[model samples]
Target: MESSKHKHYHVHDFDSRQFLENYFSDKSDMVFGDDTLKFVIDNLKQIFSEGHINGDILIDLSIGSFIHHLYSACEFFKNIIVLKVNNRCIMELKRWVDERTGAFYWGHTSTLLQEKEVNSDHFEDKEGHLRSAIQHVVKYDLDKENMTDPLVLPPADCVISDCLLDAISKDQDDYIRYLRKFSRLLKPGGHLIIIGCLDTTYFTVGKDKFHVFTFDEDFVRKALVGEGFIIDYCNVKKRTAVSDLIDYKAIMIIAAHKEK
Candidate 1:
């Protein structure tokens, strides 16, 4: 594929609202509702409830203004720091965090998560808890040696990223390089949970097409191992929804720990 044919996320201006409406909305036509959203929430709930992932601070480096995955995380981590590469995404997230008008409604996503909980609380309580847990929403530059730059962040107890590697990476080397950066944010033996689509080259948000680096399950395992992470759990689900917006062979969720 020619690099000129597709728009890179690093250089492009992504419409956070359009992206959310396209995939994260509760509409029946939203393809990623079950494949990506539900799958990630389920895995995260199980991972956090399992008692192995211990952490005071969790750094989230997910793509877009997504917070559904973090709903389960807030229960385990005292502080959640979200890192975004796009300013629009940061503002979008802040809208939700600050309870400002025009924020994307996440009631549906919260309801999905509540169903998985043994003794789930009210939806308002869940939303409130998640908002409180989010301590910071900061911008990061992957090209910089220090991704967070002048704001030198403390070593996190856990780092969770969703679909970020696929969106930013131009190739396998780029994926591995970002993985190393993610690992560097963690303390030795800290957990790292990742959720991403496999064999996807591009995904459309509204009229704009964005690049998505295609890779297989074997490559992910090898990459994580090479980055000094011990894989504890991995689950791959075949794509069931047929959609023109995105073409992904499968979706994968991985839970690993940095080697001590």
Candidate 2:
């Protein structure tokens, strides 16, 4: 594990500091509120509509800071494999798992399924069973950049890319390369769900360029298609998790494999 709990990387100006300062200052809960959850849930519903989920989804918990996306995913599908390659992310994920309820919360980090509780209702059973709907939550750690290596992933039906790609690459070419690696993580015809932002201008947040790639929907669609992903659904949001800060907005891309 790295010396730091989280991997040290480039930081960009995203007004996160100001928001946090104001947040701790007791200015407003709106600093980083539920809009992201709404966006994530809405996008997820659209993805679900495009295909049927059969409890065999694999979510790239690539950045396990918040389980908002994971929780929403579990609600729709039963079995989910959450993979986090970063040690810090794994530690963070551990904090997100609730010790008591075994339910999903903002920053839980305990085991959702307890081994000692056999037939103890630890797993989420089928509907009307009074048990949790989500059964197993498999966890793995692999560095994001090493995802292409065989050791990082296992076969999956679907993959979720939430706030991950932007933190992985510096240019469009590298981003495409990264996406291709992500593609390989899934079985043929598996789905990839991505959510992140794009701004025309570069801004700084935590000493890094927050908007390294000012991606437009057209550019991203072209890139995904070029990289062998068949576009299933795409939604361009005028505002994202950082809508209050700048003129640029975010885009959500949900795609699947092209018929070969």
Candidate 3:
């Protein structure tokens, strides 16, 4: 991982509305909604299209308060588990998982995936499948050695980490350590899908700012390869919108497997 000393923002609070507006509102207005989100989904969809993804458990450990990324992988796994270090984030996701009244509109994501499949009428079925696939949404604490802490988890078939490391980690070294933690949660030969903020150092959420550990594609590849992973797919897309909320120059997605 690459290292650089910079101003790190304090993660005081998390708001669902603010989070969505900053990242997922629209391409023209937001930092992530337009081309950025699609590239992420497209890379995942590419992996899903190649088959061999059937697994009993898929862990969404990315700390994403929304299910946009899961829209692509949920169909490939029998069970989905979401882990987050923030209580507010967990609550936000729970509200959506329970079919609460004011959940974000994720219809477009399902529509995108539906267009890829031959049977286009099963969009509802996909939603139902995802609701069923997500069996657990638990609290996580990155500061602890055992991220799960008191609770022990069964070996995961795949672990998805997206824009999470930079959110909580203090530095690039810490980021690498947390990655080892993620690898420990997976079984040998299991998949590790990571999405990163390429060459970005910070992001704003609500009133407080959060630090993003800046790194490039080379560091990412070397980090995963050093961890005994064979990168199957990797891509990076530069950010389109310019805003203080987003400080990253690009977004990256990687799909790799642990060596058995």
Candidate 4:
């Protein structure tokens, strides 16, 4: 027999140790605002309304601030799954879901940040199927060294890489490798959502330097088209604010994938 009462579980994970803190830190006051939420919700609504995610699987690769989006998507879809490759982010996600009810599943995430190992765990979960029936895989890559092989990567209905592509890759070749990998991760007509800041320099996590690519919107748009993802929509949100008594401005890009 099992208890059927909802318990208020206050679990916090390490997955969000980097991004969440940054988003809520003094520096974030200069970067993000209410418009960011509106920007994300609008894309979500567009995707969900298309009936693309009704019964489909969604794999949230990095599980940054977007975990909230998945929590909300659970209200519209019967099944939603998130993959947290980092132990820090996984803990944060569980904390976010502690007392919430939704149609979502979580995959295995270890403290080890190895793609091969994580992919192996995903494969074992798949058990030999060429494609897992999971809704989608939102792959977020902040560490470029881990963008190894997409052919071996798990299948996802849609892919959301938010400001991660440039953050991970050091050069265009590396970036192209990831874009190609993303193309292969989805079906011919699968959707890809990319949101990123343009002309950004670098971000730090706990004294470690993390790089950001100059996300040229025109260049990315052309690249996505070449990669075979149709441009369903494109929106750029600009923000200027004061954080830590300093002023900063940022430009963000949102693009939708086209059906094949």
Each model's TM-score? 0.97, 0.65, 0.91, 0.63
Model 3 per-residue lDDT tens digits across residues 3-31:
33333322445665677667875435564
Write one digit per residue (lDDT tens) for candidate 4, span 1-260.
11122111112222244555545333324254333444554555555666644435444443353443343344344445555445555545554355245312222111111132325465342211212232333333434444432423545566666655655556677777777765665655667767666665554444343455555678788888777667776776665444422112454545556457
- Leading candidate by TM-score: 1
Q: Give each model's whole-structure lDDT.
A: 0.89, 0.50, 0.77, 0.48
**In terms of lDDT, which candidate is strongest?**
1
Candidate 2 C-alpha lDDT tens digits along 140-182: 4224455444455456677777656665565788778777877
Residue-pair clashes per candidate: 0, 20, 0, 18
TM-score, ranked from best to worst: 1, 3, 2, 4
- Say which prediction, candidate 3 or candidate 4, comes out ahead on TM-score: 3
Question: Which portions of model 1 show Cα errors greater than 4 Å?
Answer: 1-4, 122-124
Kindly indicate the candidate among 1 and 3 with the higher TM-score.
1
Model 3 lDDT, residue 150, Cα: 91
lDDT of 3: 0.77
Q: Per-prediction RMSD in angstroms?
A: 1.3, 8.6, 3.0, 14.1
